[model samples]
Every structure is written in structure tokens, then in C-alpha cells.
Target chain A: MNQAGYSEETMTNVRAEKVREVARLATRTGRARSGEFLAEGPQSVREAMALHLHNAGHGGQPVVRALYATEECLDRYPEFEEMAAKASGVRTRLVSAEVLSAMADTVTPQGIVATCLIPETSLEAVAGLNPRLVAVLCRVQDPGNAGTILRAAAAAGADAVVFTSGSVDIYNPKAVRSTVGSIFHLPVITNADFGHTITTLKAQGCTVLAADGYGAADLDVLQDDSAARRNENQDKAMLEEPRLESPTVWLFGNEGQGLEEAEMARADHRVAVPLYGKVESLNVGTAATVCLYASARAQRRNCT
Target chain B: MNQAGYSEETMTNVRAEKVREVARLATRTGRARSGEFLAEGPQSVREAMALHLHNAGHGGQPVVRALYATEECLDRYPEFEEMAAKASGVRTRLVSAEVLSAMADTVTPQGIVATCLIPETSLEAVAGLNPRLVAVLCRVQDPGNAGTILRAAAAAGADAVVFTSGSVDIYNPKAVRSTVGSIFHLPVITNADFGHTITTLKAQGCTVLAADGYGAADLDVLQDDSAARRNENQDKAMLEEPRLESPTVWLFGNEGQGLEEAEMARADHRVAVPLYGKVESLNVGTAATVCLYASARAQRRNCT
Candidate 1:
């Protein structure tokens, strides 16, 4: 063994079972069985590893099961080397480029991938915690869109994210890869029953707003009202029932069908991000980001 | 075609020259040689056809060269049938599902595809139009992110979108598909020289702001300052030179590298969308939506 302690013998066999097992995480059923999902690329791997360390330090279980990287990738990201030295129970392995590619879902995995143990977080657990803001996806089919919304929610400091039944798997490889490691950052409730979720959130005094294209309440006006309430002691609470500054849940619907009338009716208010130009409608992910950030800004501005 | 004037013997040949030609549009070189790009699915085709008719009314060229659709697609969208009748120079044909799939980039092109003339709009032309808002993508290589920014820019009522040299092709099939018909909503300046584009925008009195993660100016603070000035008469213009209400240009860079030091220096103000959570950073597309919407609200609020 070299004194440098960086490179172990690089695994070159492309058809090895270990490589195949890692590659299988790309599928829903595969991940479900293993209780693990993949986080791809340097940025995502870094986040996952960091979270693992943070969790480990708090006497919590380290979620990362294993780490895979090419020799070139290890040299490029030395921070990973430092983490690997300190990481407990993380099996760090150097793999050939072909093996690394075989183990990842993306065409370009950027030479690193990590498999993380999926934590079974429940809606009941989240509701009990008094989450200020939550992002809910109902039947959002696209993995990329789902991941984008999740990432935005995390960026906006959303307390929890909920995915109703029929929604894409949050652990789907494309979704996990797309998230860039946000899956490790917050509580995610998957395969949730929408009715129970709404009821629980309501019981907790949370205002649920549907992000609809044709919603009656404009998001801008609501934000202005929230800001006015913050800037000046306006008590416009009676005029605007579901204020953006209040503890809230944003319900986003499917890409093609959008929010069904029943789903729209369920929310306390149907809030729309206004279209200022000729663009007919907002992309679901785009609308989700705008809505999440709106609440984030409103809630933060009021607190400070 | 039958007496009903539909279903012209359903084109079944997947290898026909016409099919191959349409398929070639997916490649940049092929599109460049043909001077055309493809608009797939119902939404994009509908927008393209609408623009064609609008242009034809003004003695301008009809952008749509031809449309190929399946019988089922036609049955689904009768509006396409009506548009075909109204369109002057557009050729329409019906093809089998296999043929349609072979011709387009996406597997599910929703049974329809249209080839349209690519417009050559210059930065100089856009600059002369007294545009209040512009979204500039500098070397953004991801087609999806580029399209998201374009779509959001259109939604925010940004007058034009600019793609500086070294950026991904705005007309790439994936980019066009991701734009979701916003491609036809506004002017797009492609292959623009960064220096000239900046100079032109500045000459037109556009306050150039770079959307950066490490910028000095916080977006929320600027927004609040703008809103306070709007609600009350607190003009803190001296402190914040590039007000949100001003005719402005936002410069965004590559997803991973972000704005170059030189590029960031050129901007009059470096603005950041504050991240309020454990998530370290924002996705390029998500950040674009937030920034664009911020300007949209500010510009609209001030006017009305």
C-alpha cells in the first residue's frame, strides 16, 4: 500500500454485480427494494457526504452507504478525500471510468456517484413539527419538474415537501440526480393520501393555497398585501384570508392537466402567478419556484 | 384524402426522404442549412401557426413551412385544422405514428410536428425598440436551462431575450420543446457579441444587473427598497443605483461556473437572490424565474 493513502486498486470490471446493483438504483422498483437512491455528479455527492457527516456527528445514522469515484475525479475534488478519511462506515472505492459510467444514470456522471439510504419520513411527523411552509406535488409526473420544485423548496427554506400518491418517485434516479442532493436536506413525505395530508395541515393551522393558472387571487397582490402588513400596521387580514406571510402549504398540480376543480376547491385560496406577457401559462416548475420564493420572501421579511 | 378532407392515405414510410429531412432538423447543422427549426407537440405548433397568421396579416412572411400530424392528433386538436385552413403558404400532411415518431426529436411529439422558418433578429433591432426589460444568457450551455430562462422571460413580459456567443442554440430541439411555445412569444437575439450587446443595452439606458450568488446587493433588500419607494416617497436611489423599476438587463451565466469575474465587473450592479435555507445554491433555471418575476412585479407595480 502506498503511504499517500488515496488510491485503492481501481475496479475495472464493467459487468460486476456491484456496478449493476448501483445502476439498478435508476429504477423505481429497484430503489424501493434496496431502500437506496443515487446522488450523481460532484456537487450532489458533496452535499450528500456533508449531510452524512452532519447526521453522524449528532448521533444520527449516516445515510450514505457507499461512495464511487474515478482516480481523476478524486484528484479534482480533494475535499472528498478529506471527507472520506473522516466518514465512518462509508465504503470508498476507486472505479475505472467505464465502471463509473455503468454505475450512473446520466450519460456524464462527472466521475462520481453515491448511494444513500432513503429515510422513511412521514406526513404525521412533519405536521407535528409545526412547519412554516410546505411544498406539495399532486400527480406531478415529470421527474425533472419534481426535482426542480424540491430544490427550489429547499432553497426557499421550506420546512417540508409532500408528494401525493400517483406522483413520480422522489427517489427516481433522474429526480435524485436533478435535485443535486436536496433530497438529503429536508423531510420528504412520499405516497401521501392528499385528503389526509390536507386535513393534517389544516389541523395544524396551515393555510393551503393552490398554484393555479386561472386562480382568482393574484400572487403579486397577496405579496403586496403581506408586505404592506409588514411595512405598515395594516391589519388587512380580513380582506386577504390566506396571507403569504402566514404558515402555508402550496399545492402544485400536474403539468398537462394542472389542478383539477376538486383539488383547486380543496385549497383555502387559488393563487396564480400572473402572466405579464403573451406567454399563455407558466411551466409547473417555474410557477413552483415563483410561489415558494414568494412565501419565503414574505415570511422572512415579516420576521425581520 | 377522403371526402371529409382529412387522412391523406396516412404516410407510413419511416425512411422516406421527407421524413429524413424533417428528422434532420433536430441537428443544428441540418437546421442551419434548411434555415428552419422544428416546433413539436400541440402547444408549440399552435403558437407557431398563430404567429404565422399574425405575420401574414401584416404582409410579412408566414414562418411555418409545413406541418405533419397524425389523424389522432388532428382529431385531438381541431384548432390545428382551422389554422391549416387559414394559413396561406403552409403545407399540411398526415403521417402514421411511426413516421411521425421518426421525424421528431421527442418520442412523444404528441402526434404532431411543424417545421418553421428561423427568424434572424439582431440585438441592434431589439435595442432600438425601447425595450423595458431584457434577459441575457451568457454561455449557458444547457438547452433546458436556456429554454426555461426564455420561457420565464416571456412570462415576465421581458421584451427580448439575448443569447451571447458560446451559448447553446436557442433553436435546439430540446430547447424549443422546453420553451413550451414561448419561443414565438417574443424576440430572441442569438449569437450576440457580449460587448456590443452590453453597449447597446447601456446606450438604450438599460441598467445592467448581473444575477450572482455572491453579489453585494440582496434582491429582497432592493425589492423592499423599491416597494417602500413605491408605497411611500422613500427614494433610496442613491444607495441602490440600479432600481428594479428602471429599464434593465439581467446577465446570467453558465450553470456550474456562474458569471465570469470580468463579466460580473461589466454589470452596473451585482444582484443576488437570497437563499434562506440549508440548500447551498439555486438552480440556474429556478434563479432565472425568481429574478424575472421580481422585475416583472416591480415594473408592473410601479406603472399601475
Candidate 2:
């Protein structure tokens, strides 16, 4: 074993105990047992290394448990080599392509895989940011949808993303891949208590809105009203409406059933994205993107 | 043969010539040769049937050449039976689950499949709509992205969607599946001439905007500027910005490489959605959703 306690000789056995241990992280139970999940492909691994280096530089807990890469990948992307060497306590090892593939969930691992510690975050951590915009996923099932929304939340500059207890695991390998490295750019809280999460964010001056298709209020109207108010058009009647310009928490629901009656009831208002055509409903990711960006846009008038 | 030229008896043979013909529609060459494409599952077939019935009633060319469903599916979704019988020349037949499985591209066909006429649309058809918003995909390689964008465009009330010559076939089975029945909701032009498409739309008084990450203009700024103009803020120096409220065509490029330099040059402005965080860029579908919805919201103040 090297200083970081990984094999010195390149891992050549596809069925080695260490390889099997890494492969096991693909499963939920395996992840729970090991407290780690796999991040495959160069893009994901590159971001993982950046986070590891950042944590190492700061006095934060290191995120990478073990990183396995093929020689060809190291040759192609030299930055990974430089970052790995700089990040302390990361178990880095060179492995053959076959060994890396066996340890990855994707058919093509693209020559790199990392076992990363599952992040733990609390509502205090999120509220500490004094977030202007936040996204909450309540029972959103698909891993891809969760990842897509997380990535969108990050891109739209949401302070944090919270997934309710029944929602898909953001640390799932496929979900991590779907993030395309945006997973490292923002804070994410998984398996959160749905009711308490909302109430807490609300206490911190966040307007909690549920994204519902059958809602009475149209999102465009609210946006227009917000703009009109921002322009100092004092209509006054619509002043009681939920303000998009304020700090906000958007609750997105499952793909098929949408928000439960209880879920909708929990929100200050059930907001719907305008469907100008005959679409039954907007895909959750698309709806979330429009909603989060609306808040981002409404809140950024001063900054822009 | 029945009135529609298919056997009246139920199709039970999984390997029959007719089954092979239907299965072949999953491929591009087969779709081109037969001028038919397969739409699997009930939601998609339901939409196809609605279009077929509408066309048949209007003396337009009937869209569905054949409709196949398992007995269990028919019992579950009786609307298919009712619509199939109503549409003239629909050659509906009940197939066993095994036979339906053999005919579908998806692992689970969810009980119905339709082989429909390949829609042929032109610049004239789109121009005739007096469109205010249009989405143009230029060499966008992913079928899922193409389909998702189409669905988003339709939902955003885009008048039509245009696929440049090298882009994915909107009629491809995977692409059609991704549309989730939105494929039948709006006019789509495939294999379009990129340069001519931009020029013609421009000639028709449409502003063409290329969505580029490295764009000179920020979309949020333009949106803010448009709102300011609407509020009658006469800052005459800022009048030169592209207006998002005007009738416009948005050109989105490939998944890997965005719009080419020449393609960007063909547009009135290369507009970038403001990236609020550290994400390198937005996913094409996410970007398209934001851009189209921005245009839709800007253009709809008068209507809503």
C-alpha cells in the first residue's frame, strides 16, 4: 500500500476485492454501508478532484475516498494528476481500463472513477447562506430528473437544493453523471424532512411556492406583476400576491402525479408555468428551470 | 384485406412479414422508404390518433397508416378503440402482447403503437402562421435533446420548430418518444437549409437570435431592457439592444460544440442566458427552455 493506503502496483484484477468493493457503491445499500458513492467519467472525476483539493486547502473533510484512473486518462488530462497529488489523504491508484470499467456503473467509464464521501448538510447550513433562491424536490423519483434539476438549480445560482426523504438519491451514480459536474458547484441536501424543511425555509423569509399545473395563478402574470411593481407601477390590488422578487423556495414534485394535495397545501401558493399550447404538463426539469430562473431573474435586477 | 388493406384477423405472428415491416420503421432507412414512422405507447398513439381523426375529418391526408394494440391495452384504454374506429383508413388491429412487443422500439410499449405518415412541412407553412416565436435546432445530435426542445417549444407556444439538415430526424422513434406526444402538437420542418431558413425568417420580419455561451449580449439584460421599454423608460442610448418581445427565431447548436461562427453570424444577435454560478454552460434543453419561455413571457404581456 502507498502512503494513502491504496495498491502501489496498478490494479489489474477485474474481480479483485478492492474492485468489487468500489463496484458495490453503485447500490444504495452498498453506499450506506461504505458511506461512499461512485463518480464515473472524466468530467465528474475532475470536479470531484477540485472539491477534494478545495476541502484539503480549507480544513474541510476530504470528499474523495479513492480515485482510480487508467494510465491513458492521466496522460490525456494532466490536471487530474496535479490536483490528486495536491489533495492530501486521497487514495489515488493507477488501474487498467478493464479494472476501472468494472468499478464504474457506466458501460464506458472513460478511464476514471472516484469513490466520493456522501455529503451531509443541514437546513442550518442552507439558511446560513441567507439564500435568495432555493429548490426543494418532494418525492421526485427519477435520478435523471433529480440530477437535471440540481444542475439547473446550480446554474440558476440557487443557494442550495433539498431533496425530500422519498426523492431519488442525488449521490446515485447516474444522478451524479446527469449533473455533469454541477454537483460540485453548489450545496445539496438529500433525504430531508419535507414538512419541516418547508417551514424552516419559510421562517427564514423564503416564499415557498409549489409548482402545480392546475394552480389558479399563472406564473407569467406573477412575473408581469413583479416587473410592473419593480417599475413602480403601483396598481396596489395585486400587492397581496406572492412576490417573485423576494427570497423563495420552489417545491417540485413527482413526474407522473405532480404535487400531492397536502404538498400543495403546505406552500404559500401553488404556482404554475404557463402552457401556451396543448401540452398536458411541462416536464419537471423544464418547469423547474423556468421557475428557478424566474426567481433568479426577478431577484437580480439590482445586480444585473 | 380489410378496407385499409391489412388483414382483418388479429395479428398473432411475431415474425410475420407485416411485423417485420412495422418493426423496421424504428430505423431511418425503413422510415424513408415507407414514409412511415412508429409511435409507441398510449400517450403518443392517442395524440397521433387525434391528429389522424382531425386530418381525416378535414380532408387532409390521414396520418396513421396502421394502429396496433394488445387486447389488454384496448381494455385498459378504451379511448384508443373509440378513436381508431372513428378515424377513416386507420387499419386498426388487435395484436397479442408478444406481437406488440416485437413491433415496438421500447422495452414496454404500454399497449399501443401507430405507424404514421411522415409529416412534410416547409417555411411557407410556418410563415403562414404569422409566428411570434420559433426554435431552430442546428446540428443538435441528441434525439432526446431534440425531442425535449420540441416539447418545450410547443409548451412555450412556439409557432413551429425547425431542424437543420444535419440535425437528428425528428421522426426517429427515440426522438418521437422524447416528444411525449408534443410531436403532433406543432408544425416541424426537418432537413431545412440553415442559411436560407434564417434569411427567409428574417425577410418575414423575424429577429433571429443565436443562443451562444460566448455571446456578446446577455439574455437577462435584453429582457430587462425590453421591460424598461415597455415601461416607457426612454434611455435612448440603450435602444440598440435586441428586443426579446419581438417576433424571433432562436438557433440552438450541437450538444458538444455550440453554434458555429458562421451560424452565429447569420443571427441578429448571439444571446447568452446569464450563468449565475460556476457551471461551464447550460444543457441545451435547459437553455432552450429558458430562451423560448423568455421570449414567450416577453411576447405575452399583451395577451395575458
Candidate 3:
């Protein structure tokens, strides 16, 4: 026991039951039953530890439960040692490279993995927060796309990200890795009811916009119209339309099948990112990022 | 044979030598020696066939050399039959699902795959085309990121996309699959000298902007300044300031290591997308898409 309360013992057995359980976390059932998830790679683990330390100081529950790293990884990231020392409550243990590899989801784990509590928030709680910008992922199946959307939402200053019941599990190791630590930056609500969530957002005075391919409203045209209106009249009413620059909750659909007719109808406006070339359409991740950033830019412009 | 000249003979044996050769195409050496690449999934194969048909009518060599599909895939996409009929030079054959799986890079082959020529072009030819908008990927490693950048560039109406030496192969099966068939929409030049390519673009009067994490200029500030300038004065000289809306080439760096210092210095302007939240940075793919779309929207506004 150093200041961080890390154990001195080294866990070298790859076949140990503890290591096997950690490896099992790579599966969906393992995560659901255990109520825990693995954050692999140095970037994710570092961010998780940092967030844990921040929350601990504020008297919140520790997000990181256990930390495992090889000697080399520990040496590469000395800040991890400082974080572990500060966390006090987290179990920090040294493990062999092979053992760490077994616990990781990627082919190359970079020798560090952390077990974290699955951060969950209720749909009502999220809506009660009065978030100006929100991202709703409906029936999004791909883990990478889900993670990338979370990252984009965080970067664009979104307050929360909501994944409906049909969406991929945000705790999936691949999805968690894709977030590149953004999973810890903001509130992410999972297994949410799509209809109820949208209704709550609408009730809270957030304009709900559905991103679709054959949308009646074009994103470029919307932006141009907003800009033109702002230039023509500086009236508050004209500037306050629930359009690009207003408080918005964007609905992004599945990869293969976009938002269904009912889902699109639930939103205040269906907006399409205009495609100028022969390429059919943008991928979900890229399309969502573009839309979020467009709203971000518009809102920022209005502010200044 | 049907009017499309598709062979009636079905390749049911997955262990055949031809099947093994096709499997080898998943490697870089195989693609280098044969100068051919595999386009998997229905989206990729469909777009390849469409491009082949278009090129054939214009007296150019067919892009798709061979096509492989299951009977179910053919039945689902009858347009493929019409495309094959028009692409008289392409060799179309029916294959079993197992044979298609063995030839595909993904676990699920989507019942169709095609071998296509690498579509080579020279630096001189690219510059001579006087392209108004382009994307230059310098030393990017991830195939998925590379493919997404190509799709974003095409969606932004870029005239061409260039991959410098040391970047991942554009024809990597994973990269091709990620492109979702944008690989067939435009010319993608690989293995070019970055320094000379920049010089040529400069000589052709195209402003080159490098996307960097640390830069003196901010993207939003640039866009705002451009908008303000256009509003203040409608002069031709002001319009030609090589801002976001002008004819330009965007240089994106690798996933882990961003653009080299030298590469950033070579650009006429080094711009950073502003970070509004706690997330450290955006991934290369998402950042590139945002930058390209920003320029696309700006240019379109100026046009109207």
C-alpha cells in the first residue's frame, strides 16, 4: 500500500477465475448480468480514472471499480499511478501482459484495462435537466457508429445522449472504445423509450429534428433561410423559430433502415444533409457529426 | 446465358484454386501484384457495376473485371442484371454463398463481390484537371478512416482525393467496404509525394488548408470572417481571398499522429476546428467530414 491503496500482489495466472470473469465482460450477457463493463486501451482507462477521481472529490460514487495494468503500461502512463493513489477506493493491481491481453477486447490491448460501473440515467431525469442540445440514437445497431455519435455529440457541446431500447448497448466494449473516453464526459442514457423520450423533449421546449435521407427540409436550405432571416430582420420572433439555431434534439436513425415513418413524423422537422456528388449518402456516424456541428455553429453564431 | 452474358455455371466448391486466389486479394501484396481489388457487399458491388456500365458506354476500359453473386442476390437486385448486360466486357459468374464468403473480407459476404481495377491517375493529371475542391490524406493508417474521408470528400463535391506515400492502401478490402462504393464515384490517387503534390496544387492556384489540432486560425472564426467580409464588400478580390468558400484542398493527417510540423507549415492556412466541450479531440474521420462539409456549405452559399 502506496497512497493509492493499490495491491502489491501480481496476478499472473491467465486461467484464474477472476481473469476469466473479466474476459467474459467482452460479451453482452456478461456485462448485463455483472452490471459492469471493461474500458480497454490507455486513452479510455486514463479518462475513466480521471473522471472517477473527479467524482470522488465531489462525493459521488466512483465510476472505476478496478484497474489492471502491465508494468510497461504503468511505466508509460505514470499519471495512472497518481490517479489510483487519489482514488483510494478503487482496486489497483498489477497483472502480466498475457493476463491483461485476455481481459481486453482489442487484438492489442495496450496493457491496461479497467472495470467500470455501467453509467445509466433515466429518460425523465435526462429531460428534466433542461438540456439545450441532445442526441437520440434510435435502433442504431453498430457499436462503432454509436460510439462515434457519442463522441460527436460531446464535441458539439451536447448535454446528453439518449439511446432508445432498440439501439446497440452503449456498454459494448467496441462501442465504449470508439468513444475515446467521451463516454465519461457527458450523461448517456440507455434502453430509453423512443416515443416517451421525444415527447418529454418536445414538452421541454426543445425542437426535435429527425435526420433522414428523403427529408422534406434540406439542411443547407434551412441554414441559408436562417441566415437570410437574421440578416433581413433583427426581430426576436423571426430569430426564435425552432429551426437550426434554436434548442434542438436531433434524432438519428439506424444504419440500414433510416427513421421509420412514425418516427420521422414525431419530430418537428425532418432535415436532410444535402448530397452534392454521386455518392448516395453519408454514413450514420459522419452524417450525425455533420448535423450536430451545423447546429453548434449556427447557435454559436447567433450568440455572438 | 441470359442477355447479360452471366454464366449459368455455379461455383459451389470453396476449395477451388480460383477461390483461393480470390481470397489472397485480401492482402496488400496480392493486390499489388495483380493490380486488382475486391469490392464486397451489395452497395459496393452495385456501384462498381454502375460505374463499369457508365465507363463502357464512354469507350473506357470497364472498371469491374469480374462479378460474383449468389442467385438470391441477383434476384433481389435485378438492376445488377441490367448493369451486367450493359457492361459487355465484364465477366459475370454465379457463385455459392460459401464461395462468396471465402472471397469476402467480412464474415457475412452479403452474397456479392466484384474484382475491380485500381483506377490509377498521375499527379500531373490530377492537377491538370483544375479541380476546384480536393482532399489530401497524408500518412493516414486506418482503412476505415481512409474510406470515410473519401466518402466525405465526394459528398462535399470534391473533384478528387489523393493519398500520399506511407498511407494505407486505398484498395484495402476493409477500406473499400467502408467507402460503401464511393471508391467508384471519383478518382483516388495513391503513393504520391506529398511535397510535390502540394506544390502542384499551389501552382494550379488552389488554396491548401491543413487540418491541425494546434493552429493559429480557428475554423469558426474563419467562417465568420468570410461571412462578414462578403457582407461588407461584394468585391471580386474579396471573394478570391482563399477562404473557406474558395477552391481549396484540405490536408488530413494520420489517426494517432496528426500532420507533421513540416506538412502543416506547407499549407497556406492551418485551421483548427474549435472544441466546445471537455472531450480532448475529434477522430480524424469525423474532423475531416466536418471541415469538408463546412467548406461545401460556404461555397454553395457564395454561389447562390
The candidate that achieves the highest lDDT relative to the unseen native structure: 1
For every candidate, C-alpha RMSD to the true structure in Å:
2.1, 3.0, 2.0
lDDT tens per residue, model 3, B1-304: 3536687689999999888888888999999888899999889998988888777778766789898988899899888888887777888889999999988889998888899988867878878888878899999999988998899888888889999999999899989988999999988889989999999999998899999878677887777656655555646446434588778889999899999999998999888888877899999998999888878877776645
Candidate 2 displacement at residue B53 in angstroms:
1.7
Candidate 1 residue-wise lDDT, B50-83, digit = tens: 9999999997666899999998998888898888
Ten contiguous residues with the weakest lDDT in model 3 chain B: B233-242
After superposing candidate 2, which stretches have Cα over 4 Å from the reference? A1-7, A233-238, A302-304, B1-7, B233-238, B302-304
Each model's DockQ score = 0.85, 0.74, 0.73
| Winner of 1 and 3 under DockQ | 1
TM-score of each: 0.96, 0.94, 0.96
Ranking by lDDT: 1, 2, 3
Q: Residue-wise lDDT of candidate 3 within A49-115, one digit each (tens)?
A: 9899888889766799999998788888888888888887899899999999888889888989999
Where is model 3 more than 4 Å wrong at Cα? A1-4, A228-236, A239-242, B1-4, B236-242
Clashes of each: 0, 0, 1
User: Candidate 3 has what TM-score?
Assistant: 0.96
Best-performing candidate as measured by DockQ: 1
Native contact fraction per model: 0.83, 0.73, 0.70
